[model samples]
Target: MLSIYIHIPFCVRKCLYCDFLSFPASERDKEIYAAALLKEIETEAFRYEERLVDTVFLGGGTPSILQTAHIEKIMDTLKNCYRFSSKPEITIEVNPCTVDKEKLSRYKAAGINRLSIGAQSVQDSELRALGRIHNAADFFAAFHMAREAGFDNINVDLMSALPGQTAERYLETLLKVTGLKPEHISAYSLIIEEGTPFFDMYGEKEGENGVERGLPSEEEERRMYEETGKRLEEAGYCRYEISNYALKGRECRHNTTYWRRHDYAGFGLGASSMVENVRWKNTARMQTYLDAYGKGKIHGNVKEEIQRLGRAEQMEEFMFLGLRLTEGVSRAEFFEAFHEDMEKIYGPVLQQLLDNGLIDTGERVKLTSYGRDVSNYVMAQFLF
Candidate 1:
């Protein structure tokens, strides 16, 4: 399946923990960016004109910050440029403060069938501490507005392991969100990046300016993670993939494309695309992208970096990426795709993982719950 991603790198306020390319921008700046994005999409869509697009994800900084008409223009342009499935899973990532009921109505009218709302926490204090521009009330309002606007497929984005977060408090957010019964939910743990405010506050030695950030202790974070899974599982939301829970038949198809190693095209600022066995990332610098696109550089060569994968590279990626799924990678499919037995190349490693009780060696290999706890380390063993 072929999917598409559009990055909107404009946020109302950059959260303290954010390391994505999004930042605060004026309406005029966003409009200009959208225009540039349109140009890129119009030019690049032709390359995949023959492929029936399965999903189109409008991810952000915050896509809802765009005016409804701008969104409509982009969707219209995409429809004009490519062949989409009769029922494409078109999703837009929305920030609560940016969209009202009327705006949500406009979004529905504009063909956004799914909404991924960023509602990080339910506590007003945590919202402020996380640098979120909206309070819990704002999220509730936005969520109900989307429902009133007729969105049946919605995903609420939640974060755990935040500073000053307790296991009970985090569980409360999970329980409260699950009560809404959105079609999907994505929960992520806070990882401190080197340059962000979070890292600065917690990175240095305690004797230095690195006072306690009130970050959840590692053990508390582990409890939060376990409870997250247990609660969601009991709520009837299947843990289809790590970090995501969905009703059966309601997984985020666009993201699944990534984990399943399907081809996709990405547009807009700092987007990444992998098609025709080559992976490339767009230039992250806003002015740099604008300059190139402004000069008619929408072709494949416009990206910041492009790399072609060898057979070995592809196989490793297939194993690691597929392992991220609860179902794990299929050995038969691996042989069919690469024409080599997966066991032949990674037999020893697989045996080790199985012996350690980190993975199962049935018809397909999958991670155990213990494996998922050290998944980063487990997955890295696949790299050769």
Candidate 2:
């Protein structure tokens, strides 16, 4: 089985904190980009012919911003290019403001079996602070509209530790979204990535080593994370991944493929893929991608940057990505895949983590409750 990812790199307006390869484009530009994206998908599918693509994820700069016709064409192209599993899990990432009853209905009609609504916060004030176009009202409307369109498998995205956010406000977001009973919830803590408005505003300190302003304290952030797990669990959504909670049997299969280190192909601008030992990301520049599409080949420079991971690199990724899940990695599977005993190679590192209560050193190693709080450190030890 294989997974396919399509990246739609157009947004109505780039959010303040977003640093993805998304841009504001006119409708005509969208049409051009969509045509090119379909071409890439066709070319890649031919390279790996006849394989069953079990999962397809349309993620973006808000894929909902694309016209229904564009989406339908993309779906049609995938079906024509490859064999689909009998029960393909097709998902589209949508923004609250970009969709409506008709658009969602068209999505269902186009074979999108899942919806991931980017409802970052349920509070209007927080949404405004985050420079998000949509508000609480918009999210509710979108949620109901998705349900009305017959989407049973839905994932609501939320963020905690936001600027000017209190513990009370974070809990409010959790309670409100969970009350809606979406099949999954991705509650993430805000990270101030570089080259974004957030980094410019808060990344600089007034004086030497001055404390960061407007953000919650580390202790406060910890509270928000812990409480989120408790609240979502009580609401019947189990914590599956570090930031993902889902009802039983409704996890995002496409994302799970990444964690399991399975092969996946990414299409469109700035899309990346890990097929066997080779890993590559498409050109992020718009004109570059268009030029490549025109020439019927990915640009030479972009293709030249491809990384063929060595054995150590593969093991590092296998451990780091697999450890993000609550179920963790199996030693047996690791040996089968890498032909190296995990215990023999990493026994001391595993012992150190276990001694500090970061991971459970069992047949299948996984994070302890306390370990998940400091998962970064645990995963870093696996790095080559």
Candidate 3:
């Protein structure tokens, strides 16, 4: 089975820390972009007629910013072009400030069954520091509106290690999120990407006046990750992946398909797709995408750069992606896929990690508390 990702690359205003390929919306551009997206969908549907699609995710610059009619148009286009499974999981990413009760109701009616709300933090000051427009009250209102609109499956996105975040504040934010009782929670550590405003401000201001302007220290970040796992699990939210927690059977099938190396198609400007062992991306510029689509440029900006997976790449990816799961990879599944014994492939590294109390291996190999704290390092050892 395959999953589909539709990129809505339009936002009301770009956030300070965001470096994604998106721009503020204009009436003409929105119409043009939506049409181009449908065209690309048609192109992809014809290209991959053999695969069954089970999940569809609409991520972006904040899909909530779109009007109900625009969303319905996209869904209608999908129905016309491709076949969806009986019960496909259709998810849309929403920002708190952009959604209202009416819009939420219309979204459910438009066939969106899942909502991923962007609630970075509950604290107003923290939200401002992160350059988010909404306050905590707005997020609460949006969450209630989603429930009122018949959305039972909801995911909340939270960020840790902000510019002025403290351990106590971060814990408070997590507790508040858990109190809301979402089905899924994705907690990510803030990374200051190079071109973003946060990066420029913090990167230039550091060490000038004893300023601590960047991300949290390595030690602090590790502590935050460890505490996050412990707290979420205690709240009855299982840590299915390093950065994600969910109740039973609530794991995101779309994202899991990627981690498991399943085929998927992506549409929109700057979107990437992996199908039939070939990976390619669309052009990033809006004008370029529209021009190519309007001119019947079927393979515009597409390049097939195929890298056949050898033993090392496959094994390394399996270990890295599998270890992201708290339950870890199954020994039977590993051997079935690779035709090699897991114990024979990297026995020394596993033994070293297990001996150091960083991982546990019984039925399935999983990260111990120490291992989760230093997961990147543990994953790095398996890369070669």
Q: What is the lDDT of residue 206 in candidate 1?
A: 29
Residue-level lDDT of model 3, residues 1-384, one tens digit each, is 778899999888888989987779887778777877777777768766766678999999887777778888888887777777899899999999899999989888878899999998998988998888899999999999999999999999999878777778889999999998999999998866779888777764333421465456656666777789889989989878888999888998888877777778888888877775556777777777887675455545432344556667777878888888888877888899889888999899999999999899976888987788789999998988
What residue runs in model 3 are displaced by over 4 Å at the alpha carbon? 204-211, 214-223, 295-311
Clashes of 2: 0
Candidate 2 residues 59-130, lDDT tens each?
988898999899999999999999998999999999998999999999999899999999999988889888
TM-score of every model?
Answer: 0.96, 0.96, 0.91
Instruction: Give model 1's TM-score versus the native structure.
Output: 0.96
Give residue 334's lDDT in candidate 3 (0 to 100): 84
TM-score of 3: 0.91
lDDT of 1 by residue, 1-384 (tens): 589999999888899989998998888888888888888888887688789998999998988888889999999999899998989999999989999988899889888899999998998889998899999999999999999999999999999878788999998898889989999999888877878887777784223333365777767788999999999989999997889999889999999899989999999888999997899998888887787666455643459679999998998899899999999999999999999888898999999999999998767989999999889988999999
Model 1 regions lying over 4 Å from their true place = 204-211, 295-301
Error (Å) of candidate 1 at residue 156 is 0.8
Worst 10 residues of 2 by lDDT: 204-213
Instruction: Give the range of the ten consecutive residues with the poorest summed lDDT in model 1.
Output: 204-213
RMSD to the true structure for each prediction, in A, is: 2.0, 2.1, 2.5
Clashing pairs for model 3 are: none
The lDDT for every candidate, in the order shown, is: 0.88, 0.88, 0.83
